[model samples]
Target chain A: MIDTIAKLNGIIQILALVLILIRAFLVVRDLTKSVTGVFFMFAIFTHLSADMYYLIHIAMNKGYYPPFSAMDLAALGTYLLFGAAAHSLFPERTGERSETIVSVCAALFAAANVFLWGYYSGAWFQDIFSGITFIYLLVTSSQAVYRTGALKRDKWYILGSIWLTFVAGQVCVPILQNAGAVLAANAVEWLNYSLMFGTFLWLAAKVILCARRTEKDQALALSFGLMCWSLCTLYMCAEPFYQLALFGETFQLLLMWFIIERRVKTA
Target chain B: MIYSENIFICIVIPLLLSLLFIRREGFRFVLGLVIGMLVCLLSAYISAFTGTVSEMGHEQVAVYISPVVEEIMKILPVLFVLFIFDPPSDRVFLFAVAVGVGFATFENCCYLLSVGSQSITYMLIRGLAVGVMHIVSILFATIGLMQMREFKAMSLPAAFGAVIVSITYHALYNLLVSEPGITSVIGYLLPGVTAVLLFLVNLRLRIRVKT
Candidate 1:
């Protein structure tokens, strides 16, 4: 069952990669492009690059994942690119003291996870790298939200909260499972699925509303990518329905691509 | 057992001396080559140590760990130069390719020394595949770095993301080529295909920029 899911997940990524390559080709062809659009495309590329490693691991290990590998760095690259996109779109500088505090806190939290879970040294290295990048994403993304004004803040909040809940479910599922609370773990997993479904429906509504708007906000479009990325990372951490997670991610990418295509056509 | 350092020393001395006659970009390329060879040697030691500590087989280590080490070592100089000298994007790209070439050349030498250069076809494939793979991977990272810098979004996540693209590409190649036969053929062709695509994309972009 797991192997089948892994293979299916790999297929989804390949399909998504093809879609991304087409989108990238289009974006690259368009001479009049924003920095945010470029970064957004690159973010997808980096994320897909990391997925290649994931696919290779599936083939090599027959669905069993190694405790740690350098490929995780590419996933980190995905977040970094998204952060770059957020920064480019918003271009607001946050307070260094606050950024530092978040960094410290993230580092401490990562360290706690490392010790609490007894992660290997290699995993610890990646965990720290992710921690630092995650904080950067949070800081830049919040800055982006702040810069987007009042009207679109609700969209950011909704998507952001859904991502947070999914990630929280990811965290709890493992802890619950480890503690022999199988029912609780199962419950958390179901909640994650429900949240994913809810987000999908919510995004569908938003896409419709966004399409109807006269001035399509770039910030909201970028936020969708960010939400998809956060979802990707959460699934990558403790993947229960790994294939489903990837399907959701690719679906989000498709929607974003559709938006870009529509905008270009209208332009 | 291969004495990589001996080969490195023998090749590097002449190159180091040639640097006196060379200037500017030529100097940077030669210097990058020399640094790349040194980095390759260091990477070998590190990989060996890691293999020993992890109790992994040679093939396992090569496929799983060495790509990460090699890619990181290859990019360190580029990163250093970027942050310190703050050179133009073209210079950085040239320097990066040079480092990759240097690293590939040294690796090929060691490989040839270990296994006799009997099979011309195999050697050709190895040279084209491995050499271009190294250059392509590093160039990918360099381009990412340049993009981030150009956009004034040069943060840790951005830089690392750029670096990790190379690492993942290297790792994927390593993973693919580790097994022989069909997979190996695909692996060998992957870099060349990617390079051609990148070249075409770059040409298109340059034309757009000019127009």
Candidate 2:
């Protein structure tokens, strides 16, 4: 069963990687149109390289490697790049207090991870860096939704809640597994999948609706990108969750395409 | 078995002397080169200590730890310049490239000493591949930070994000090249491909900004 799932994961990763490459080319071809496009391209490029690394590892049949590797670092890079994309896309209209609140939350998240996971090595380093970027992304996307005035904003808040719950579930799975709570870990793993699937559905609906609207809303597209980013971070931590992460990546690439397509249309 | 310090001293003296004649951005460039070499040495010490403490094998250390240590060390000077000197934003790229060049040059020297420079083709490949990899990785951070600075959205996350991008790229290269066969070939070519892509993007972005 596990072998079948692993093979499925590899197949889907290759599929997603191809999609990402095509999207990257499209973004780069039209990149001169907007500064935000450049950052988005970088974000996509990181995902491409990271996914390529994993695929190559599997192809090489190199088994039982270190727990932390290029994929972890690349995951961190992907989040950071998305955070950059958000920063470049949205204007910095939020006050310093909001920034501070986000920073505090990020710190608390890091502290919690350390308390749970232990400050060991590369994983810990990635966790702290991921923590900061994660919080920044959450705040920036929420802020984009809040300020865009196009979406209902309440739906975004709800989406945010679901995504956070999924992340919390992901963060707990390893702890439970490590503590020999195998059944509990499996249960949470299922719960995480449901939450992520629902989140993707909600986001897809949001993207389609926004596209149907009369006005072109950049923030809505960017928020969708950022939300998908939140979903994509955990594949490094959980092996079973790889398929769902690829689903999230598909959503992200489609979002990038939407943005580029919109830009080209407007141009 | 290679005496890295001797190589450093032999190269640094002339570079330092040349610095006396250079001025303005040229001065900063030479200074950046010198600092890059210095940081390369420091990174060796730090990675050595980290490897011992972590108890990982040499290959593991090279793939997992060295990139993080070396990238951070390489970027330290650029970060210092941004924070303290606050040189013109455009000049940051020069400092970044200089640091990467210096670090790569020193690293190549060490490589030659460790394994005699028997094959010119291999040396040329290393020079182009590893050298461009270093430059392109640091440029990722430099360009990201510059964009954030331009947008007035430069935050701690953005800065760290830029550095993390560099670290991850370096790690990916190290991981790929650490093995033999097709993976190593991909690793060697990755840098040049990325450099070309980034150059075009940077050029277009600059033109967009100016116009």
Best by DockQ: 1
lDDT, candidate 1, A93-210, per-residue tens: 5555644443354334333443333342345555665666665665665555445542254555565466556556767877898899999888887877777666666655655565
TM-score of 1: 0.84
Worst 10 residues of 2 chain A by lDDT: A113-122
Q: What's the residue-level lDDT of A221 in candidate 1? A: 44
Model 2 chain B worst lDDT run, 10 consecutive residues: B149-158
Q: For candidate 2, what is the TM-score?
A: 0.80
Q: List the residue pairs that clash in candidate 2.
A: none
Q: Write the per-residue lDDT of candidate 2 for residues A1-267, one digit (tens) a residue.
A: 756766676567557656755555544545535556656666666666677667666776766555546676666667666766665555656564644544454345434544333332346655665565565665555455444554454654564465467558867787899999999998997887777666666666666666666345543444544453445444333555665575566665666556555765565
Q: Tens digit of lDDT per residue, candidate 1, span B104-178?
A: 999999999999999999999999999999999998888878877776777776677777778878888888888
Candidate 1's C-alpha runs over 4 A off are: A29-33, A62-67, A93-129, A150-192, A212-215, A218-222, A225-240, A260-267
Model 2 root-mean-square deviation: 4.8
Task: List, residue by residue over B1-211, the lDDT tens digit for candidate 2.
Answer: 9778888999999999998898988898899899989899889889889889989888888987888889889888898888898777779989999999999988888989999899999998899899999999999888877766665667675577577778778877887788888889989998998899788766756665677
Q: What is the lDDT of residue A146 in candidate 1?
A: 46
